[model samples]
Target: MRLVLRVGGLLIAICLVVACADATGVPGASGADVIFSDGFVPGQMGNWVIEGDNAGQTAVINEQLVFELADNNIMQFSTLPDVTFDNFILEVDAQLLEGDLGSSYGVLFRMQDSTRFYRFEITGDGLFMVERRDGESGWTRFVDRWTETPAIQQGLGSTNQLRVEALGTNISLYVNDELVHQFNDATYSSGTIALDAGTFVQPQAKVAFDNVVVRRP
Candidate 1:
């Protein structure tokens, strides 16, 4: 009887290990394919470059671009040149380092140049907006905007996920698992992607980002 009980326990342990292995193998949860990743390790600064004249923005010890806590965390692409995409899904995580009165940060897609692109932004106040730019219009008008009930201000320096799916002319934006915006624009099928930061009141703001994934569709 003792031997039989020992064997049963051993079998249970094997089964548990197998279950864990299976769970870890699952996609989109355990780990991603990781086409590109940056831990901001020093001496590994080729894939990205800092652009613009923004002060207080630098790669932190964690290998991430950290906006000065008082600057509204506004950092832009310093190295990646603009490119076009046909169909793809882009995902990024951004956090506000300091919650200012009107602090905001976001990702830009279908960006044709410094002046034009589709803007998807979120604020410390749990508000979000999607807008488009046509020529010199300056984010012409918002395609969608809303204030999330219960106000999802994670906290100062808390990261939040932002995802955009583009298939042909159709586009969709998701924030923290919620589908916030969707639209169709045939004017431009593809362009570059960018990060954006804007000033609000006086305290300034900082934003940090990580886990930026882009998958071709």
Candidate 2:
């Protein structure tokens, strides 16, 4: 069930659910038309394009899309199919299988290419960040630094339901069925989406993802 929390005239939507792995395959939503999904049960990447410093580090392990990278400051991203939407909800299940809680992983959407895209990320240490990439020049943090929030479940081996919704120019971020932060910015309107995982200070960060579903919001 989704609840729209109106704050300062901006609509922030978060789907409230007790157990994230419950009934529907469509995140926490009920009766939503699933646009695209990948469970990794086939044990293959298929047409997904790999990008970043840890480009081909992602693989299908134990029926989940897992990215196990080496060293810090390395990010691995796997671009999916034609998942461009002006107003839609994108949700995926991710787990910190191995690494320090400071490591971060999430989704990248509204991408112009491999280098230009908007990223929404959540750390295992109860922190979140928003970033925009500018090709070889690198990324610029919209929030400047990592912002801590209790909405994210901390510690290793923890699972989180990461959600990013783009409704017009409004974007909301949610984790574990709770709204973390929201902002409005009209940048790229049409582009692809990708799964991203990276490390901060940890020597390595390993995360698993599955059941990615996109729907109309």
Candidate 3:
């Protein structure tokens, strides 16, 4: 995962435009205003930078952060620039606009860099996995393969709410407010959080993310 890089801009040091009061009792969360939201200001992409195929673009459409990809075997991520965190809860809503059922899109938090990070990915086909990258060590799945989960809303054009909590050696995964899986790994203690999209056996996956909230315990 560390050796892999492409074109995608990461939004760091930004604020979540709208606050989600509903996240009151999220895991590892306490009452706080730790949120980063982006509706892509008109004419301004804020602090985000793009990396990947020229056919892809990131913009604000209909008050949502949109990531449009191309028909290529590639992955793109949007994250913060110079900020990092550990032991926090990150939440976001992802909608698959156009893509195959096998395509994947989700959040990546505690990202040490373009090479190292923890990824909580869910496919449009209703599969989810917890994995991470360690520099040149390559990709290692904490949950192993992309496991199918009833917690996810399967199929394209479906929107799913994803959340992850990283505390100490314990990590918790949630889908649509349901606790689906939880495990522990002390490999990464701190890094930046990000939203990512990828193409698996298929090509050209488009996923939109919104209402990103990060709370620290």
Winning model by lDDT: 2
List model 2 lDDT by residue over 1-217, tens digit each: 3223321122332221111111223334445465565555553324443322432266667877778877655566666544466677888899888888877789888888666788898888888888776665556666857898888878888788999888888888888888887888777776778787777555677899887877776
lDDT of every predicted structure (CA atoms): 0.55, 0.68, 0.67
- Lowest lDDT sum, 10 consecutive residues, model 1, at 12-21
TM-scores for candidates 1 onward, in order: 0.71, 0.78, 0.80
lDDT of 2 at 113: 69
lDDT of 2: 0.68
Candidate 1 per-residue lDDT over residues 74-159, each given as its tens digit: 33332234345557787777788765735667777786755456777777767776777665443444453345523345567666
Q: Tens-digit lDDT track for model 3 on 117-210?
A: 8888888888887777776666777775668889888877777999888888898989999887887888888877777777755667678877
| Lowest-sum lDDT 10-residue window in model 3 | 11-20
Off by over 4 Å in 2: 1-32, 43-56, 136-140
Instruction: State how far residue 101 of model 3 sits from its true place (Å).
Output: 1.1
| Model 2 steric clash total | 0
